[model samples]
Target: MRCGTRWARSNHFRSLPQRPDSMSIVLTPQELRSHLERFPRVSLGYYPTPLDHWTQLEKHLNRKGRFYAKREDLSGLAFGGNKVRQLEFLLGDALAVGADVIVHGAAVQSNYCRTLAAASRKLGLDCHLVLSRAYDQPEDQGNFLLDRIAGVSIELIDEPLGAEQEARKRRATERLAAAGRRPYLITYPQSEILGTASFVGAAVEIFDQFQGLPSVPRYVATAAVGATQAGLLLGLRLLGWKGHVLGFSPLNGGEYAIQEAIWSGIRAVAQLLDIEPSLEPNDVHNLADYAGDGYAKVSTAAVDAIKLLAQTEGVFLDPVYTGKAMAGLLDYFQKQKIPPEEDVIFVHTGGNTALFAYHREVLSLL
Candidate 1:
């Protein structure tokens, strides 16, 4: 593979010095082949998603800095999302393991479920989703509508906040099994490891993408989940990228949930891929400041950020995740945590569909 300084000029490249210890965990071309030896991955996504700079948003924020976005939303499985990459590896594993049905639990607007449903259809597996409908709203918004249109079997549990919905998913899975169908739980606590591995795979691509940059990025930011952040951080460490990987949480949950998920994902990536690196609990940074009010609640700041991006950059941000993440990024700029010369990359995990559903809420901001 080619490597050089000019390669760093592109928005995607972040230059960094080579780590001697990187060899220990770094997968050689041969090692990558061997490491992914038994892993079956289908052509379910558009790999090497473009890493382009959000110049308009950067200028609108008036930051003395560079802001880039990795368009993971264009993953091309269903409507696109960061989950597609994970689903590529995950659904591949499900098929390899002979799972005839896929089941997961999340909120009604889960992009993962939408992608999972599409992937399951492609793989000829039945997809089931358990959704928590705590808010009194129709399910025809964003991903919820997509899930219905995808013909995914769904069970809506009307539980308030703090309710444990995992049990509902388990019950749904059991129902499928009782009906003589083979069912697999796709969003178990244990699946974080597998999910993280998918991001690790993504990080490998990023390493190649940035092979020729002069100055490496000081930080990389993405929406927090057990898998995406965990996998990227672990993969970056494996590839000798020493910059900070920040996982900004869109949810209003305590710090523990994100940390636990991150650590679990890191461990999973290390063990499954045979990569070694020190990942401490303290090293995990989950920014909850942008979650104004709570998860699913659209703060004024987030709404403003979303609208600003759309008007300035023609980019749509979901009210739940990316909007809040962008809010956090802007907050950092306002607080002067990020200097102008530093390179900052934001992972656009994608949920623009949600913006349409929340159009009224967003319009009110104007």
Candidate 2:
């Protein structure tokens, strides 16, 4: 729940982790792209997902500033999400290490594990999930159903995201090793940098996409905890972007805990890039105000957001992730934390399937 403890040294890096160079060098978007591309990766999702204008949302909300959605939901993988970008680098390392299977542990309906399963199947690799049966998704729906369809092995556990769930993943890894299968446990912090590092590349994508917009966004808001937020922070900082990243969390970790994980992730990604971590942990706008009830639980605002976005923009936001984040963005607009006249971008990390899993909750509001 608290995003696992701070990242210990990750052992799965594509290259040896190095300290950030003491020198500060401002890298252009093009230069940063070069630096990021040096790492090993396998293409999975469609890159540079469209930064489409929320053409109708402005008038729908009667807002002054323009709004846009960075369409990560269209990331063209198994029901796209922000995780697909991370997995390209993650699975790349998995294959490089001669691994035949990926062992991942997460919430029962995690978008990360679901996308990972689909990516593994696409690559002809096996995937074994150690899912925490902590949430109330009793029926096989949303990500769980998709995982079932993918035909990956599942070891369901009664525990939440504490030690036992993680231990199950370790035990599964041992079993696989004994069975002569090369396994890559994604929970292992070692190779996580590979995934987060790819996000720096995402920042570059954002920078390039903004060129056609009215102005660079004042805030880039999304549902993120650790690696995704870290990548955006590091990559944006590296590109000398001035905008803030509003990381709206759906999980109920104290703000400090989530912020610390994000900070640790930022440092790790910077080390991998061999660049100075110029940003501080406090630099992250890790807001929990919009995290409804907690991870996977429904919230009134999120449902309203889902309904509003679907009706106004013909887009759907999942209960677990994007919906809550959309709520946060709207709240910011309402509270004037983000001036209504200032342009903003919402990164839609997809999981609309989760809507079906919350039929009772969503339909009650609808």
Candidate 3:
């Protein structure tokens, strides 16, 4: 949140204000692509998702600058979400090590679970999911249903998402290995770090898409858990762009934990790309206030955001991730944290399938 004298608010780039010398350096899209090619990748989703200029939403808000949503939501996969991007590199790592089975875990209606299952099937690999019972409803709808359709092995645990649940996933991976199956645990940090490369590639793609002024967003925001956000920041850094990367934490609390995750992601990703990390902890902003009551619990504001986008732009955002992020974007706009004069982008890290699971809550808001 400490982006000082941004070009967005200052005369619309007709005259730009002074920034640190680090901001002066810029890299070409091809340079970033070369660095990204060093890592192996699986083509599970479409590359360079569209940068949509939501003029209808902009008209509704009556903002002067350009308003865009980088549609990672429309990633061409089983259901399409940002997880498709991460899984490309993550699954590639699995194949590189000859992994025949992929083991992962998260909440019951996780976008990651659905995407991974679909990708695993695509690559002819077995998939197993150790899911936490984080929801109060039947798991017969939304992403869980999709998982069932994928025919992946499923273990629904009574625990919530935390270290204990992570341990459960590791144990499951070990059990798979004992059965003489080659397994890759995507829950591990090493595998998770590879996901960063996908988003870093995303930043490079978005940067190239933004070739003109006013169309270029000064603020790039997303629902992040550090690694994804860090990769985007690294992409911007390598390109010598100091655009504000606003991260809305889907998890409601734990400020320190969020900061640690993001900083570690920055460090880990830089190491992966063989560059000294140029991003500091302070540079990262994990805004968790918009996370309603807790993780997976949709807030009133988030529902409003979901409704607004759907009604105006015909874009549907899932209750858990992108909806809350859109809420934060509006909150920032209201508070002038992201002023009206500067362009802004909300990175739609998709999860609309969860809408069916949270139908009652979403309907109440309407």
Candidate 4:
């Protein structure tokens, strides 16, 4: 039942020949699921999300590289997004531990909070959301609307970071505990490990889809938020995928801190799976330049990128995360950072619901 030992017994391990390269460990989707079965996971999002070729997008870009999109957007929960995957393990842990209330903190229009609110309702658990403000906007829209619709108790805080926000979330947890309610706090350094583990399963799905391609992808790109990027990179490493996994920052955090967070998640996942950590510090690649005007603020390039994808590929990307990441991917191609013939897979982490909050900004692109 150990990590490496269990992997060795899987059909994928027995069937596929080991590569000559250093990445010899590989796990198929089925094997990966089997390994993950040991963990507590409540079924949340739809699995094995669409992996389709973005031929129109490639044609529009007039680039030599073939482009594919792994549609995590269609993950199928509370309008669907990357958070659904993370919530699977997170809420599962809550229910497993007899938690009656779920507490988490995020931005005013956080897709994470929206998804968590819906998930808490579905699991029949009381949901409490601590919304931290980064701007002076007083309007409640987009994911915030959905959060309210889900009947989650909301606490708005002026502090978005540092000790103040942490103190607020801690006090909320204490209040719930005082009422004899078991509360599960989903915050960094606590829920991130389980949250990241969900995307390890996602990587397995990506690998399986690549098998249909004439050639394997050269790169996989996604917006980095520690958990998403970290889990994906770790899963790809475990699967022995040779492609580069690039994380484009959607927040203001510098590359070093982002990499550290990702690396921490990777180590946590490795420990959770009882496997030897194969990822190194260098493997945590992040592009910080695409963050634009900081967290949740859409830049001109991101707005244009959002428009282009919608016009050409009929795929909607949110102004916050995916649009910024798409802008990074476009910049990479324009700068010729990736070779001409190589294929790239972009992970659409999903935030179309948040587009409502930035309707004016996105419409201005036209």
Specify the highest-TM-score model's number.
2
Candidate 1 clashing pairs, residues 3+ apart or interchain: 4-212, 8-212, 8-213, 15-216, 64-340
Q: How many Å off is the CA of 271 in candidate 2?
A: 1.2
TM-scores vs. true structure, each candidate: 0.87, 0.93, 0.90, 0.90
The segments of candidate 3 whose C-alpha lies over 4 angstroms from its true place after superposition are 1-26, 212-215
Give the alpha-carbon lDDT of every model: 0.73, 0.81, 0.80, 0.80
Per-residue C-alpha lDDT of model 4 across residues 1-366, encoded as one tens digit per residue: 011111112321234343344333566667667767756789988988999899998888887778999999999998898989989987876776678898888778888889999999998999888888765433567888888888889998888665677678778888888888888777667566776788888888888898899888879999877888888888887877867899999877652388888888888667656666466789888888899878777789898888899899899998889999999989988888988778999999998986889887777775
Worst 10 residues of 3 by lDDT: 1-10
Model 3 lDDT per residue over 1-366, tens place? 111111111222223332233232356889778767766679998878998889999999988878888899888998798889998987876786678998888888888899999999999999989998866744989999999999999999988877888888778878888888888777546544677778889999888888854556778999987667878888888787877899998886762387777777677666545565456779888888998887888789999999999999999998889899899889888888877899988899988998998999899998
Over 87-159, each residue of candidate 1 has an lDDT whose tens digit, in order, gives 8776766665566888786778777787888888888888888887876444767788888888989888887
Worst 10 contiguous positions by lDDT, candidate 2: 1-10
The TM-score of candidate 3 is: 0.90
In terms of lDDT, the poorest run of 10 residues in model 1 is 1-10
Alpha-carbon RMSD to native, per candidate: 8.9, 3.3, 9.4, 6.4
Question: What's the lDDT of the predicted structure labeled candidate 4?
Answer: 0.80
